[model samples]
Target: MSKHPLLVRDVLKRKHFESAKLIAGQQGLNRQVLWTHILEIKDFDTLINGGELILTTGVGLQLERETQIAYLENLIRNGAAALCIEIGDYFNYVPAELVAMANAHDFPIIIFEEVVRFIDITQDLHTYIINQHQQALTQLDTISRTFMELSLMPNGILKILQVLHQDTDALFLFVSEDTKSFYYPIEAKKYLHLMEDHCQQLELHEPIQLMSIDKDHFVIIPVNGLGQVWGYLCMRSALPKPSDYTLLNLERATMSIAQILMRNRMLQERQQSREDEFILALIQGEPIDLQYYQSYLPMESRNLFYRVVVFNMLDYANTFSEEDWQEIQLQNVMFVRSIIKKLGFFPTVSVRQHEIIILAFYIAADDMEENRDSFNQAIQQIVARKTPQLFEQITLTFGISNVYQSINSVQQGYKEAKTTIQMQHNELASSIYYKDLGVYRLLLHQDHVALLQYVKDYLQEILLIDQKNGNDLYQTLCVYLACNGAKNDTAEQLFIVRQTLYKRIERLENILGADFLQAPHRLNIEIAVKAYELLKKTAPDILRF
Candidate 1:
């Protein structure tokens, strides 16, 4: 149904206003007349509430010219839609100054050339407006029912936007939390960037309001569901201001969209809970019949290659309340799932407290190395482009495992992914792959007790010496070893002079022995340094020494 409010021009067609002449304010003919009020009083301060068509005799205008002008100004200031004055009885005509002022403000002045009852005009317009409103409510109810039916469909969100677009002929855009934007009427896609730019500038928590962009008007409505905002619905139109009926229609449509979103979320949560259980079982080394559960997996082909990626939110517990942390975790899961899907991988994702675990699958290609390179590049893009957008103050660390041909090896992959994250010592390198971990690859798999004993055997004296004196001997030894026993490079890296480096080296040799830099001792010392750093990150309590 085409729902529109009663306009001033429509009021002129009524029988009571048949003899009325619009004396001024020709531009105000299109003003909406929501209700009619007969105000004979000179003081109309509280009586006018905008959009009210006032019916009056010239009784108030029979006062002084200033009082007459003040009365008209008061009606205009209070946002009365129009002034209908009887010209024959109380006054011969509307004053010249009043007509000029009304014309200037586009405040309509309708003068009755013959005597007419104020009650008849008001009763006529008020009944029509009330009946129009009742009819609008009935039409809105029908449209609402249509929306509810649409919500049950698989493409309910797009369908909802389609119906709204068809009803209003306005460009409809829905932007989801994952930054996935959907537009109706296909041609409206050109405005996607424009709407997104405006959305970014808006304070999302604010109430729905009209916004003008590049001379076009848009009604931005937040699709709120499940105690959170799922997305934004922006309806663009050529109208300077949308009519109240259109706003009402859009509000009803937005509520239906929210219902669709909530329904989809609930269904996804149900499916996700089952998937999480399955993934948890796999990662926990529970025996599973892969053939029996093939439908649950993202891919059913046994020829597919699988890899696990674990995303760890660093220091989230300290940074956010428990409720906020849960919300963050939920957002991270959805965000990561979108990224993985965009990269063309079927991602089986699960969230465990602070960690998001994703098992990615791709069909085994002829050139495995090229596939791996593409996967790494995709991951790099996410880390470089998307991570900063979602996590400004929060830090996210990613660990990727080596590819496995069999799904049965998922437990091993999960361990490797977690270990890859744990073995990282530098916070600057947020994304790490198992294949790129170098010597830590070998040490990470070793028992913590063995790793700790190995670190103590090689660097026990130096660690104790530095711990006692709070000196740079341990760091100097690491730099010296890293620089391949080159004193100059080591001193440059340490920001120390050669003589000072010589003294530290002399101190290290006295504690770790003179041949520590030779052959196997050099290799062992390097391994011990790596093991120490890894343990410091992964198992700090083991390095009590």
Candidate 2:
């Protein structure tokens, strides 16, 4: 049913207005009449509110030509929808100038050739306006109930959009905060790019905006929840302007969308809270009930592999406020979870201060190596797709633990992941797996004093000589050991000639012994070199003499 407002043309169809004749303003027959009033006073500045049809005898118009003109102008300026005058008493007819003025301003003036009761006309039009209002309220109530019922369905969001589309017969678009767009009828997908481009220009808290795109009009309403705008609801139509009833439907639809979003957010927050507790218990080595483990974990069988991944945001806390930092952590956690899920792994995520921890589950395949490779490749993909769109200046470092088959060993896996991140030395690689740490794994567990002494025992003489003379002895020795004592390879790695390398090696052997490169000594020296590099990165002061 049409819910458009009462217009002047509609008013002319009433019995009380049967004798009425339109004197001017043919262009304004479409003007909406919200209410009707009778005015006998010459002063009506406060009496006329926009969209009221004024009925009167010519008593108010029995003045000079300019006064009559001013009276009409006053009514028009205050937005009276139309003027219905009884022409028998007080004055014989409306002036010619008044008719010309009414037509010019598109302000309707109606004159009754026969006598008509002002009371009957007001009562009839007022009843119609009131009944129309009641009908609109009833329709809105029905629509609201329909939306609430649809919100409980499995595909509630899609169904809500469908209801709006069916009601308005217009294209409906929902653009999420992540820039993902959902359209009704599928063919509306053609407007995806245009909607996204316009969304970028909208402020989060802005009210509904009516815009014209390519000669078609769009009504954009913000879907707000949880103290922020979660997305936008857009309606596209060929009409130059939406009817008030259509706008009401769009508002109702927006509220339903916001309710769904808010409900989902609350459910997710509760789930995340439980997962956080579970992850904390696992990492702290607390005993967990079997029922709790199965509920929170994807443990289809005991043959599955469990691994922990830790992500640390670098230098972010100092840059943002505490509130903003927490928001960033949440955003990053969601991003990591989405990417991990896309790769077909079950991920339980938790955020602790500046770090985000994820416990990823993988079902073991017949080829264990292939399973491990696939997991590693998934991690690489996650790092590659890190949230550059949201936080361009943010840098993240990831550390993965060794795989464990038993839930009891998850604590150890957590320790391994933390160690891999702590002892990380490669600046170029953002992600490091525990098994790839090599000798640094052993060095990471050694006591600081013991590690410092071991480095001193093997390289103390060369370090002191290099410090005293500003020489290349210490660096040359590290390259020579790394190159497996190959003179040509060592020289090339050090960016020096073979003759210069020979001189450095000669000085090195003179300081220590000729057999320093031999089996046990060579191994000890290599361990010392690795220990020294670790200390230089993690504890430079501890390496001092």
Candidate 1, residues 78-114, lDDT tens digits: the string is 8889999888768898878988998899888999888
> Ten consecutive residues with minimal summed lDDT in candidate 2?
422-431
- On a 0 to 100 scale, what is the lDDT of residue 344 in model 2? 65
User: Per-residue lDDT tens digits of candidate 2, residues 1-545?
Assistant: 13668889998888888778999999999888888888888888987778899988888889898889999999989999999998886878888999999999999999998888778888888888788888988988999999999877776778888988887789988987543468997877888778878886787545778899678788888986533467888888877667788888888888888778756754564468878888899889888775865667885675677788887765777888888776666666665665676566788888888688888887766467235666767667656654544345766666788877777887888888887777653441234788887788788888999999998998898898888999999899888887889998998888999998889999988976788899887888888888888888878887775
Residue 282 lDDT, candidate 2, scale 0-100? 84
Candidate 1 matches the true fold with a TM-score of 0.55
Q: How much lDDT does each candidate structure score?
A: 0.80, 0.80
For model 1, the run of ten residues with the poorest summed lDDT: 422-431
Looking at model 2, residue 156 earns an lDDT score of 78
RMSD of each: 9.3, 12.9
Clashes of each: 0, 0
Query: How many residue pairs clash in model 1?
Result: 0
